[model samples]
Target chain A: MVVASRKAAYHHKDGEMTETLVKKNMSASRTSAVPNYRGQQVELGRETVGNVRCANPFMVAENVNVFYGDNHAIKDVTLEIGKKEVIALIGPSGCGKSTFLRCLNRMNDSIESARVTGNISLDGGDIYDKTLDPVVLRARVGMVFQKPNPFPKSIYDNVAYGPRIHGLAGDRAELDDIVHRSLERAGLLKEVKDRLDDPGTSLSGGQQQRLCIARTIAVNPEVILMDEPCSALDPIATARIEDLMDELCEDYAIVIVTHSMQQAARVSRRVAYFHLGYLVEVDDTDKVFTNPHHKLTEDYITGRIG
Target chain B: MPNQMTSRARVEAGLSRRKRKEKIFRASGLLATAIGILFLGIFFSTLVAKGASAFVQTYLLLDVELTAETIAPGGELDLEYADFDGLVRTALRNNFPELSGRNDRRELNRLLSVGAGFQVRDLVVANPDLIGTTQEIWVPAASNVDMLMKGNIDATVDESLRNLSDRQIRWIDTLDQAGRVDLRLNKALFTNGDSREPELAGIRGAMMGSFFMLVVTIALAFPVGVAAAIYLEEFAPKNRWSDLVEVNINNLAAVPSIVFGLLGLAVFINWMGLPRSAPLVGGLVLALLTLPVIIIASRAAIKAVPPSIREAALGLGASKMQVVFHHVMPLAMPGMLTGAIIGMSRALGESAPLLMIGMIAFIVDVPGGFTDPATALPVQIYLWADSPERAFAERTSAAIIVLLAFLLLMNLAAVILRRRMERRW
Candidate 1:
């Protein structure tokens, strides 16, 4: 039965490839169309791939299904997250994009009657391991929220919060250094250094968003998952964060879930487009934006549908 | 266009009705304000007319020689002793040197207070050097003299019941003319502790007792009430047990304060055999009465804390406990303190429960500790107000003033704390 299921998964992949070819040719406009490459190999040979490797290709998804009371939120969808890459999960409202993000760090556990199923693993390592503390796992995989939420505490404390929780600093001086470096990486240190003790909430919306990024980076997570982190900020804050993401790629694998197609194009090296709990297409960011392979992906990239 | 015109007419009709209703409401509000002001005016005037004369006390000062031979006439024996009454009478007679052959001195002696002797004895013992020395002592006059000083005495009374003889009355007249016998304002009437003598009794002890009791109430109730509120409002599940607990808390708040006093009588005093009339027992009872009020108010305050703050804390990797204690508690503090102050103020004015548990009048010395027998301000007022002695009327009024002052202080504290903790969001 296991072998049969494995074979079925491969067949599903082949069928998806054929659908990609059909979608690219059928698109009315390139603006709305993700150009589908039929039989065109994505040569992730030398330059595209990196030194980082995932321990296992087979992502074990155990009984993972979500429900909001009688309403079935996310179906029993299973997928693997590969190392040294980006995976963007997209869906319309109530399709469970945020729910899935919460499940990654057991953030869903806080919500009442919001049940989750299926065990998602990173390199076959049980993320929901019995001995694994959620706080520790959260430290390993940091998340950036949709809204810019900074503590009423000082700007320095806002960035240093995660580091303090994880005991990442040797002393006050070291913690201060970490806060400085993280803020610098987020492109906010220069603007806020003179008033380090000023409340983080006192900053502009864009600065607050950058402060949140600086906070996430202070803990030094292996994977950074952003959930529409730029949605609440102005276009300038959004652009600055996108540029920060480009700079972050060398040190950590970044997975960003964004509503803006232009933002995905500007920031991500690679992009995986999702539609209704299915990975429609995965390719270079430029190709996915200028030319999508799936019908839904193309429709979404343009103004046709989301 | 016809439908639009009809809809506009309907809107106009609704607006006209609303305006008419507003007029009626304003008229009724004015009536209510007049009624409220009338009631307050009546209350103030009634209290002033009935209570004003109680502030002044009639006193007699005389040079009483404290000779050990006269005090201990028979000399030393078994227990310690002093003839304080003999000393007081001799001092009064000595002050009136012309009363040697007259029987008016006996009737005139009745004008002195019962505790006047105790006052002289205490003074002599305190300053032993005055044992053989002549000391001018000031002591409260009798209740009759107090009435006479306040002009409450009727000169046309029936001869059979008229206690003061014409000669003694003449001496009183002479004293009055000399300005040695006059009604002076008594500061200690509101500031001193209770004593057996009506003249010596004051609300100060009961005030301290109530103050200390309220301190204990705030210390115990604030933390427990806020913790319970936080747990119930923020973290506890909406199961049957928690729901039942919530219901019980509401019901407990409505239970009569006397019921809690009874509980204290049984559990704290009888069962535990704690000292009766102690402020600790009284405080514990009042705390029980105030706890439910505090819990309900704190829960409302905690509920008023926006969920966004909790989300913000949780998203920052703070645990569930941290989210509440750090963010939620600080935001809810001002409201909690206000609730606590109000609850404590309510507890202070309560008399029935304190009366039920022997807090009526532990009249002696001031309370030295929690275990010491003490009366609360309201309880002292109740005792004085119930006394048959007409002189106690003034003391009762004075007690009410003290109680009112304390309530004002607590309310002021609530306002200041509420303002201090006010936040923008």
Candidate 2:
């Protein structure tokens, strides 16, 4: 009820101006929106707006900073991911949304120059503790990259790779069961049921992305982090992956980093907006879209700033 | 409108010059390629022209009376300690009865190869029952006579200038006219080992030596080089130590191969007490010479594998070792094999390193094992080329042809294996 009232008040105060600005920006040139918004003298917020807490927080990151050599790639940011909810991180390029997502699985450890300092915990256990192996952490917190990088192996092997490495299955039959279930959950089993022996690279772009997701989920990770998973896919494939993400939220806490506002709005329950490596707003997806309290989030949502 | 028209005209004016430049560049490239091919054609034609005659050998058919009295010298048929040379001399004397003087008989005997006695002994040993009867045997002629029969020696030259005297030439002509002289396929060249007699010399020993040395080279260099490449390319931390190692590896490839021979001479021969002139020592030296090449090639191949594949495997929770062995190694195998084959071919053709280890010695027996004293194909060519005999020149060219053929075959195998492996991806 409070979100509805706030959204209505926002519509009444700036509805006409925002509509005109959007229309003019779409019809005229892109440069005009910046000047019109600058005339408003909008103040960019330093701290996060809206509620950052969830009813059931399971994975939490606090004061995370990442540096790649001398470059500060990701600044201090804090957020919480609920146990069974989809949180989409939306920002412009180089805004640290992807970097933050990589931090969850410690994928940045592969970069020789990258150093991460933060308190990130899964189930109240520190993920970056020396005793906890990155390999073990990655098995529990899986990732999908921007590009569909399937191993140069058969589709069955691609899905079975994680389970075999983590020893999730005891025998061939159990491994086959895991592979089939993962492929079925990713919605690719029916399409590739007959040709499991075919190379994963033989699949189309969307199918390859789905294969990658199946590969990630084969280990039964508790959280699946997707770094712009649907960016490389067409609209139809993107919609399928978005729908898959929606269904996947019921079982796994999914943290997706995306550039498309519509994708974040369509698939996520809560949305976090990052601006220049800072978490400017974290709120319900509907609230962030209609009534973002931070001016930078609003400017980005209305296409005034990328 | 006028400015647009001028811009269009200017671009049109520049287009012809650009096209002319492109044409000139293409023509120069084609010209360079033509020059290379022309040089290769000349080289191969000269090699073939010089080496083709060595395939056929001239022989003299002699009527030998293998009497028990002469061959056995007893009532019992004794094959060993036989006077086979006397039988050849007696056959030659019967053919030219007019040459009764010591000088004439000696000149007559020079028409036959020194290997003729060995040939007669082999025949008599194979057929001991024919000891009491006369047999017609075709034995190899002397190198000079063979050269004259092959038209390599100018018979019109003064007898003093040529190795063959006028009497020997006249006897050859008489024998040729009587249908007793023939040109047969040179089976002895492939069957026998090295000898002072050019007509009796063969490259079988060198071929076997090369085979054993290459076996040792590949067995030692390939795995070690590829392992080093994998460790450096995949697992090693990027630090000053690794950088220094990388620089040293690249420098090792540029080191003269003979220096590796010296190292092997000191370390493997003198220090380890391995016998000199053995294929094992030669192979070890060549392995050192080839390791840098294989490592460089393997590193390049491993580097060529897209980082995405590594990332994909790593993201799947595969350990670094698993990621490399399962994905990176298989994908880089074709290129690694190509590099190894190229290195092996280079080792096959290398003679400098083997020379320092005493593989340049004159080996008369086919190498039965790696430890046997032997000479590689290139070393054999080097040895034959250094000889003063006119026939050794043709043998040198023939050995070169054999070496080139082996190199071609190895390269062809590399191409075929690469194609087969690449199709899996």
Candidate that scores best on lDDT: 2
Q: Identify the CAPRI category of the predicted complex in candidate 1.
A: acceptable
Q: Rate the local accuracy (lDDT) of all candidates.
A: 0.73, 0.87
- List residue ranges in candidate 1 displaced over 4 A: A1-63, A80-89, A255-261, A269-306, B1-14, B26-56, B63-84, B94-103, B121-137, B151-173, B185-187, B190-192, B422-425
Task: List, residue by residue over B1-425, the lDDT tens digit for candidate 2.
Answer: 99999999999999999999999999999999999999999999999999988888999899998889877877666767578988988987897877778888888998889999989999988878889888899989999989998888999988789999887899999999989899999888788779899999999999999999999999999999999999999889999999999999999999999999999999999999999999999998989899999999999999989887887777777888998999999999999999999999999999998899999999899999999999999999999999999999998898899889999999999999999887343
Model 1 TM-score on a 0 to 1 scale: 0.81
Interface RMSD of 2: 1.8
lDDT of 2: 0.87
lDDT per residue as tens, model 2, A53-133: 889998999877676654456656788999989999998777889989989988888888777776899989999999998
